[model samples]
Target: MHCFKEKICLIQIATDKEAHLIDPFEIKAAPFFIRVLESSDVMTVFHGADFDIRTLDREYQARVKNLFDTEIACRFLGVRERGLGALLKKHFNVDANKKFQAFQCGCQ
Candidate 1:
């Protein structure tokens, strides 16, 4: 899940059945989706998230009651390896390709 400013530009939502991308540029899912996200019962998950969470509160005027931050959990567990890439390799033996990380928002 990634966002630019207050609006989420790209979101990858998944379940046991399937997964889909909600591109606000192409779809009008923000208003409804933001309501769902603001629900106290809904737990939002993120990996090493920081500003995104703050932006949701500051810009979107929304609050997430339950948040599962992988980095925070790792810190709680006292794990020396905290990066998502390192954790994936350590636990699941998967290598994450960080190709899209270098891309800037609105970049061609």
Candidate 2:
């Protein structure tokens, strides 16, 4: 159960009103989100969702429905640079924040 040892530290959700940063460790109700992820009516968009999808299944038994992966879409659309930062920059003229990329989550 190597995957069980791993935990999702951050779950960011953005709505028209505001953005939410949920710390799974603090929430302790991560499984509550499984229903939302599994709902076919709700579409979840991710830049690259392979790891996230696998992790959700392994950790909470969540099988996401109506998933739209931007990376895959970009590839299908013939965008050469598929990275999130690159795509955002090219299309929206905005820089993707990588500030927390180096932050340690203590999973290992």
Candidate 3:
């Protein structure tokens, strides 16, 4: 299934000082958070934003403002590998969990 068809089980947000994982299923303040996404002052950054932006609009009717897509930036910067997992590993020495790798990008 495409990303639009997939349920957003979690929403991950990271800052310079902290990271947070929010379970959409468990949250009562989802509307409040959606408002935050729609705010022009809050710049929301995404690795590969095409699907994420579409999904947000489809699911929450939230239109994100002031978006900075890093994958596009990497492309313009001429980074050979543009995938999030690859970039994270190359730049941060972090190994992303592979358990969900097989399920990504509408792979059967």
Of 1 and 3, the candidate ahead on lDDT is 3
Per-prediction TM-score to the true structure, in the order listed: 0.77, 0.85, 0.85
Ranking by TM-score: 3, 2, 1
Error of 1 at 62 (Å): 2.7
Clashes of each: 0, 0, 0
TM-score, model 2 to reference:
0.85
List the candidate 2 regions with Cα displacement exceeding 4 Å: 1-6
The alpha-carbon lDDT assigned to residue 52 of candidate 2 equals 89
lDDT of each: 0.74, 0.84, 0.84
For model 3, what is the error of residue 25's alpha carbon versus the real structure, in angstroms, after optimal superposition?
0.7
Candidate 2 differs from the real structure by a C-alpha RMSD in angstroms, to one decimal, of 3.1
lDDT of 1 at 64: 66
- lDDT for each residue of candidate 2 in 15-106, tens digit (9 for 90 to 100): 67898889887786676688888889888999899998998888788999999999999889999999999988998999999997646675
* Candidate 1 colliding pairs, count: 0
After TM-score superposition, the amount by which residue 85's alpha carbon in candidate 1 deviates from its true location, in angstroms, is 0.9
